[model samples]
Target: MTTSTYHGIYAVVSRIPRGKVATYGQVALLANLPGRARLVGYALSALTDPSVPCHRVINAKGEISRRNGGSEADEVQRHRLEVEGVFFDSHGRIPLELFRWRLYADE
Candidate 1:
């Protein structure tokens, strides 16, 4: 049987809006699985569905984490985010304060 954690991770990640980002830790927290940021990263890397927009998920540092196997995937993630109108600083990090998606229960 698939664990709730697996479903929770994908559901939370899917809620991140276009033009905004969420950290892996934030995703886990939102999914009610605190201290499971690494698991969030693993779930994202295993995703193959473009509809999920896994690239919208970033690290806590606001830097794009290298997806599983290669640097090329990193570039692709950056490009995907850029196309969605997210901006990165010269240090190659998204300004989380501005672009981080705020998921509220009432919204």
Candidate 2:
């Protein structure tokens, strides 16, 4: 992806408030890059900024997308979310309706 594209994704990710999460597709849509959810993931994977809060981005299923057997990173993401007061159900899935950040047209 172009640097501008990744920057757009980063901007959207940065807007995700603490204690809430957004799906990759949601980030793509908000970045005006609809239908490029996977691109959001790719951009996040390449993120080097510690302030971006990439952990707030998850899959559509409200679960962390596996990263080439990187279970440790998965744990870290979960831990961060929990610290922010996001919870996972017994199935290890977040209830998106409750924790997903919503951006209304006015906002």
Which candidate number would show the highest TM-score if scored against the true structure?
A: 2
Q: Which stretches of model 1 miss by more than 4 angstroms? A: 105-107
lDDT (Cα, tens digit) per residue for candidate 1, span 1-105: 266777788888787888888998988899988998998887876777777878888899999887556669899889999999999999999998889887762
Q: After superposition, how far is residue 21 of candidate 2 from its true place, in Å?
A: 0.4
**lDDT scores of the candidates, listed in order:** 0.84, 0.91
Per-candidate TM equals 0.88, 0.94
RMSD of each: 2.1, 1.7
* RMSD of model 1 against the true structure: 2.1
1-107, model 2: which lDDT tens digit per residue?
47999999999999888898999999999999999998898889899999899999999999988889655899999999999999999999999989899886213
Clash pairs (backbone) in predicted model 1:
none
